[model samples]
Target: MKLSTNYLGTVYQFSTLKEVLAKANEEKSGDRLAGIAAETVQERIAAKEVLSNIMLGDIRENPLLNPEEDEVSRIIEGQVNERIYQSIKNWSVSELREYILHDDTTGEDLKRLSIGLNSEMIAAVAKIMSNLDLVHAANKIEILTKCNITIGQKGTLASRLQPNHPTDNVEGMIASLKEGLAYGIGDAVIGINPVDDSVESVKRLLHATHDFIQEWQIPSQNCVLAHVTAQMKAIKQGAPADMIFQSIAGTEAANRSFGITASMLEEANQLAKVHGTGTGPQRLYFETGQGSELSAEAHFGIDQMTLEARNYGFARFFDPFIVNTVVGFIGPEYLYNSKQVIRAGLEDHFMGKMHNIPMGVDICYTNHIKADQNDIEDLGVLLTAAGVNFIIATPMGDDCMLNYQSMSYHDVATLRQTLNKKPAPLFEEWLEKMGIFENGKLSKIAGDPTIFTR
Candidate 1:
């Protein structure tokens, strides 16, 4: 599509379709419009193929799909098995410790979620992807889809995009995008739930989101997704303290994932007020689960908080956290929520004993996402095969124990390889991938792997 641009008052300047197209057909066209016109022509040429790759969300510049998908499952299985084995191995210790009175060795500790990718790190990723031209060449121009980006909104800036989820359908998404394009969307669309607490809040939010885009009036597309936060409650409950703790870990994690530091929110708020945003949107969300895992009321509470946040120009980062990659929301795409949280906590608990490694260590996922529970084993194997680190387990998965009777050759090979690579690559790979170096770093995955172990 031919995109046009216009000055967004004090916010942004975008090229509009009408203006750009009319100019392209102008009498010998103007020089200022030449670059944009040419870019438009190129995008039209490749839009179809590019769009398809995007939908797949599986396009790796390298034939690396093998890793993201394959390694995830195997690594998870390994963890399950490891846990089982440890439970059995440590059984004798329980009795022995009882006799000893005092504990001889300490347990593992949890830290914050193992450092997965966060918004703070997007600039560098944008640079890498831009170098790879993950976004369209012309599209990449509007933002930092180039070069290394500094963390926490440094000299670099992030182009915010809301997902389009008008009643959860393709048409809704497309219509929202179309409307948003007219409003000057540069990088992506973030779909949000306009409904919460009261129906009126829903209407107001939806209208506001639309108005925000319509007001901006620019077109450039990237990172399209839906923002889904539902209201739900648990059927059988006992105060849900455990879930709440888990949820808090998850919630704090979501906050972190969105590149949201306590400082950042405050800054955004300040920026809004200074710019006269009339009390910026203050969105927030709570974590929820289906099956027996979550309560409906719990879900609703999360929605209420998220809803209130938006009233002040804030957004929530809530969504299905199967493996906690923090996917599908405005917050962290770091994923690995439940595991990372627990893992982080565990690492902190055992800081002194386990060489002070964060409880949350990276596992080797093949750099893939799990579409369902079944593919986990395959995903885990691929990760082990390719050596991606920090494989977080899926919700319903067998521990990563090598069932001699049921284990496959592939699984065996992967574990053996993984074993050889200890202390662990999850930490090393995450650090390397995240651009965190070993110059006195101290997470379980950081510093010397020698200090961290299973």
Candidate 2:
């Protein structure tokens, strides 16, 4: 393929598909740290021009990571709808982007179009799209999946109520849980990132959250973010769980670092379907982020954005209830600062939607990063505008256990009101029944956690 281009009369050349993909990416500290990013803005634009002209079939045929060597590559390749792919194989990446943005391309058309796309193609189009382009195209599609209640319906936003306690204290967690419920959050799931990964700790948190849901008749799901094996063991010991939770990466080596394999994920999925508490065909929950593979020393010379898209490709196999990117939690080495974080958040959401997964985002950042709650709050609003299915909500946008700031429970209520969106349909019904929401706004009693005491 022609990998040379001229930008402003300067010749720019990249050596391989992987190099072109990496250099074409928006400025990311992670890619630069990996020594893969283009050295100049003009060079980056040159790479984008070269990439836009490349055909979808060429990207598919020239695998960045060989399927024979990487299971993630294999799984993604194995699932391609060959007939559909053949039809679009000759289209340039620029044509694909224009087709998606065309006024006549309906959400259903995008859904069908997703079947023919591989992860690399998704990442390629995203690389060339402007930030607003990402938002507008992603807003055109809606992806809804069910766990206990459905999420991702049109004009609906959901939140994962994260009541993390540093010591796995059930009462402290319940206090936070009650506070989140007071604001009409937790429609997506009451997911906890426990300080302890022990099966006992995981089970204890799962049972606590599950019992509270039953007590209040809340229309939500519950999950404890532990290692997949610990969650599996807890399920075997009869812990009440609505879904299985695991953090996945884009490469087989990276997944191994997380102590997971395709087989392991499949096994956990089957167990959740047979034994977990949720009522559905969708019961798996996955969290992915940019730069995870690099952190684990398993990036294999590919850019982080492409790696993140590979995550969704792998996740689609099990028909997950929810899959989200922890967009900025990996620190500044990967994303750098607020500008990078915001750009990555938009790109990740758009790419995930392009993969046709029920995608959400943990719009978050670490203290060390040059980002604050205000930056993520801005992202929350943008994602809400983009029709993101859900966002991670913590008490006052602070997670004491994970030591990061996310969107607050109050932020969830605000975004819904500000944007003329509502919580999930079943969740809104429960909110009305409990008098927490009324007349399309939070009621007078909405912020009172004590109401649940009665």
Candidate 3:
């Protein structure tokens, strides 16, 4: 069987794994890549063969496979896997640097190359890449790093507002938002997973957030974590439709577990487009995690990380404003510990950025996991270095409703101070206008004095 596809703006064709391996050999020989032993070259070829066979098996058993398309999909996946392995296996540090600097590689190709690399290789490559290169790669993939939903642009680090109220009370939510905003967080977007999924409850939250943004002139978007249908109802009822939120998985069955379908996503996307709110054309905000497939009994023998990347393809179809992978939020059942969590988070970010999706990570841990703030800090720093679009910023890193520890307001501040970063462009402008920021530095504003009164 033969297959063809475009990767990083380059068209590639493959008839067999050996053809891909031969290309790798050619590149290696042409570049005369230093320090690579002949034994290592042969080992990489063997690894490529192993990966191709595994992908072929995965395609054969894919639950989404239809009789009409299964053969074509199998052939395509085989070729894709072979190409990915070939690209990474022969990549030299200098070659990768050149690609980062001058190659017109797209996010899709980056994601394919990323998924083919291990965590160690990702870290090593990241060390050699400048922040500009990382940001440029993000743009090539069309990832939105700013909270204002700008595309194909790079700016300061962005964060989200995740305030949870036990009874979905509007007042409690407002108070939390006030505190977060006072600390210079929530500039990216303010989103909440409603304790109540009812349209009335979600609508109230949306209206309140919408009103708050208008009253305070906050330069951000608002989202209520209800089903797209319910959010659509709220939008029709005059609630703000800044962004629509949903949890997505790779396979149809896994997505079905969350009461979502591709058709439903399409309907929501159309509704959001009709009810324009943000500064950009994109409006969908999606969240995904690694173990969701297995939890929904939809793994189909594929590894969790690979399945997570596949989910991003489903997400990319919507031209989403943000595609956040809630890494380590699923608990120890999916990712065993900090090492596993860290690797998965990196993999998810790399894959998402490579796909040119506006990627964010909820660098978090569940109570059942044997991880701590230090682990989250390390992962957050690495992701920031890799130019991740954003991360969740909660009070003290603990999410009250979700029962997980994520990056905190202090963490965001620290990241900015340590990395000399700022907030999204519009938000930064707003902050400067409000005297909250001066000369690209955050002022030492005291906490909202009226937070307690509110």
Candidate 4:
């Protein structure tokens, strides 16, 4: 009921929940560009103070985007457990944050807590959490999802081999794919970002990666990141897809801009269930980022962080096998530099995990974002330490097709070895059998694409 807070002998009052949410966020160019960020550091702290004391029930009742107008809101609302909500409806955001950070709180407790809270509550708590607090809280939770292989088990890290090409060249993608596999990557998936989003091109790439997995008897899944409609058409026409992929946003209007709707996603999920090549019920892969809603002009004055949390809320509805945020790929406009990218990456991973989704991060940056490979490499290490399910890797961290840099095959190997982690269980076994990995480390033949050529 109260939207005013006193800090350092000054009174700060926010007129609406949206204003408080935006002002409470850490400095982000996207928010500033949207003209909603706090005007001063003291104002930012005051907003956090106001937000922390706001009740969970108040957030739920306020509904930033009306469910009547937004399907994302409806989806998130439908998923909240009413019984669980009543039990924690009176808890303040600060109370919830501390409860999550409390040493006595177990992973199961957090899981149960996730059921009671909605995306707004999740985002609210994240605003007040420091970087390490986000990591520490997220590290307590383990979310495991299975496609062809299980990912996100404790002590295991996974990688999605993105073998993108400038012209949809199969051989060029295969070159990168073979090299990545040699380094014990691609356990999460051999996913590609196609230069072509056509059904035929999608099918071609899917078949290429699928056949390679079949020939090598590799323990992994494959996807081509085309439009959901293109993938659906390809799958219906008998494309051998291990998983269906789509990029999702936080609002109905943004989703429309992406050419998706809840019903359309539901149809895609059903199609994958019957026709997808993966082994289980979880077959959808979604990529979300912080600034997507704002980019599409659908944020409705809300901050990017809250919109991002809404993404996880929507993603969990379909029970995705894997979900990742391309944290820095939207460029410096959304996340200005390494510091903002790192903060957003950690926030996204933690928020996704809090939503109980299999969360990964594309620790990445565009060339013009005042960030280099080293910045993303630092993020890759941080996310891995926080028990991220997987990360996106390109050949030498360069995606010639997308013109962005992410973590690399070599970085995946380094993260695994340095942090005492392994790939997904079946993938690790296949690696050891292929002599790419031996005794918990890469073998002599590792990092050689020629090994797969034979």
Q: What is the TM-score of each candidate against the true structure?
A: 0.20, 0.99, 0.74, 0.99
lDDT of each: 0.23, 0.94, 0.66, 0.93
- lDDT tens string, model 1, 280-312? 122222222111101112111121111111111
Q: 24, model 4: CA deviation in Å?
A: 0.6
Output the lDDT of residue 214, model 2.
97
* Local error of candidate 2 at residue 102 (angstroms): 0.6
- Once superposed on the true structure, which residue ranges of model 1 sit more than 4 Å away at CA? 1-378, 381-389, 393-419, 422-454
Per-residue accuracy of model 2 over 48-131 as CA lDDT, tens digit each: 999999999999999999999999999999889999999999999999999999999988899899889999999999999998
lDDT of 3 by residue, 1-454 (tens): 2234444454455444323322222112111222221234444444333323223222223323332533222322333345565645555444554664566765566655654543223323333344445555554553554334452235467888787777777877787887777667876679988888899988888888888888878888889988888998888887776888889886666877788887788888887777746555778889998778777876554345545766776676677888889988877777768877776777677667755577888899998887899998998887777677778898778888878899988788789778777778777777777666778776766245263244
Clashing pairs in 3: 107-354, 141-356
Error of 2 at 53 (Å): 0.4
* TM-score of model number 2: 0.99
Quickly count the clashes in candidate 4.
Answer: 0
lDDT string for model 4 (1-454, tens) is 7999889999998999999999999999999999999999999999999999999999999999999999999999999999999999999999999899999998889998898889999999999999999989999999999888899999999999998999999999999999999899999999999988999999999999989999999999999999999999999999999899999999999999999998999999899989999996689999999999999989999999999999999999999999999999998899999999999999999999999999999999998898888888888888989999999889988889999888889999999999999999888989999999888789999999999867
Q: Which scores better on lDDT, 2 or 3? A: 2
User: How close is each model in CA RMSD to the real structure?
Assistant: 26.3, 0.7, 9.7, 0.8
